[model samples]
Target: MDKEKVEQLKIQMQQWLNEAEEFINHIPPVQLYTAVGVVLFTLILLLIIRLFKRTTSNTIILTGLSGSGKTYLFYQLRDGSAHQGTVTSMEPNEDSFILHSEKDKKGKLKLVHIVDVPGHSRLRPKLDEFLPQAAGVVFVVDSVEFLPNFRPASEYLYEILTKASVVKKKVPVLLLCNKVDKVTAHTAEFIRKQLEKEIDKLRTSRTAVSDADISNEYTLGVPGEPFAFSQCHNSIIIAEASGLTGEISQLEKFIRENVKP
Candidate 1:
């Protein structure tokens, strides 16, 4: 703190700087340039990696016709129990949270952005806002009552599979058959086959119409071939779940596979 001590420290700091400068001057120019380049490259690389990780998507979209148990599944993921009997959502129900099932896992966990888009036809367009950044999509179906909703579900699913974002980005889709807890619930295979059949019919009807009436920009499947989910550019998978009974391991698996946490 004294003036003499401060002067001594300043002199020592100057000497250190001079020594550093002299050492650098003595080094070969090529080696010095290489060292500088390496450091700058490393810094740039680290910055780029940080930006990519930050921008990586944690979003998972839940979409299906109304009463297919998407809301139930959404609550079950966030709260570990379905908040049953609530009114249907007019808009998307979204939140960033660690899955309740993963709550007991050790160490820090990444948050998942779950967006449960309303299944009503009028609200389906809202899905476009989230599809670009989505890590995955779950298309729910009311398994027990699937027959009544089959045509509409096929149309919705066709639109999703053909979306530019979904097809180009290769966004993975999980077709979920919900209400499997009921004794009369359809099997996953049956639902998949029936959906294929329905979509095949829709593909024919829609392709025959004008583009103005056709909401799908991209074609659904191979021309003159029977429609199947395997024809999709992106991965289209079938799964089953029971929101009420909490049999959702498959759904959780799909989320973890895409989100990495």
Candidate 2:
């Protein structure tokens, strides 16, 4: 009877041990799965937050020679009209303007901060301060003055591109050949070709500047390529700002397609 009791006690102890071992074995996998699930959930949440942040933020900077319709574009963007030209100095305006379109019914397009910097040579310093923050640049060239003003326009563009390259390399630039309506003789393609020729000349000038051993000349480091050939490879939007012939729509489309905040 004593031996039988001892055997029964041993059997009960063994069963308890087995049960404990089973419990212990079950815990790690559950804990591991829980940990992995938590980690995955956290990562997914972070990714979603990052995506939302990126999609929400959008800023476009408009820069060009004075009288090229920078302010007109700004006003048109606000009131959807460009009856008269508007000019503003390179001052910060904290006005939030709505960009409405039938396509974006949800009003996802929020405050478009339009920075209208002075295009005069005197304002270059101020432009340097503001342009780096631009997600994209719209260069409005006067089509009527393309021949005479081409050099200055090209030089200004080069300067902007050089500065932006150092800071915002991926920013897209839309070279708008404005005042196309004034010149009924020249087609949009013709004007674009003329601009391309001027751009090529500028490229040659830039290359010369780079290759020249100007030990005597005041050096300001090797300037970046004024324009990325790849970016220019895209379509050049020609709009007659004098009369609104869907120019605003074209501008909006360009911004939507190229510039992501």
The lDDT of model 2 is 0.60
Residue lDDT tens for model 2, 2-90: 99999999999999999999977778787968988999999999999997765443566667776666766765665666645454546
Clashing pairs in 2: none
Question: Across residues 1-261, which tens digit of lDDT does each residue of candidate 1 receive?
Answer: 999999999999999999999999999999999999999999999999998875579999999999898999999889988875266888899999999999999988889999999999999999999998998999999999999989889989988987888887789999999999999998999999999998999878876888776564688779999999999888988988888877899999999999986
lDDT against the true structure, per candidate, is 0.90, 0.60
Q: TM-score of model 2 relative to the true fold? A: 0.63
TM-scores for all predictions: 0.81, 0.63
Return the top candidate by lDDT.
1
Where is model 1 poorest over a 10-residue stretch in terms of lDDT?
211-220
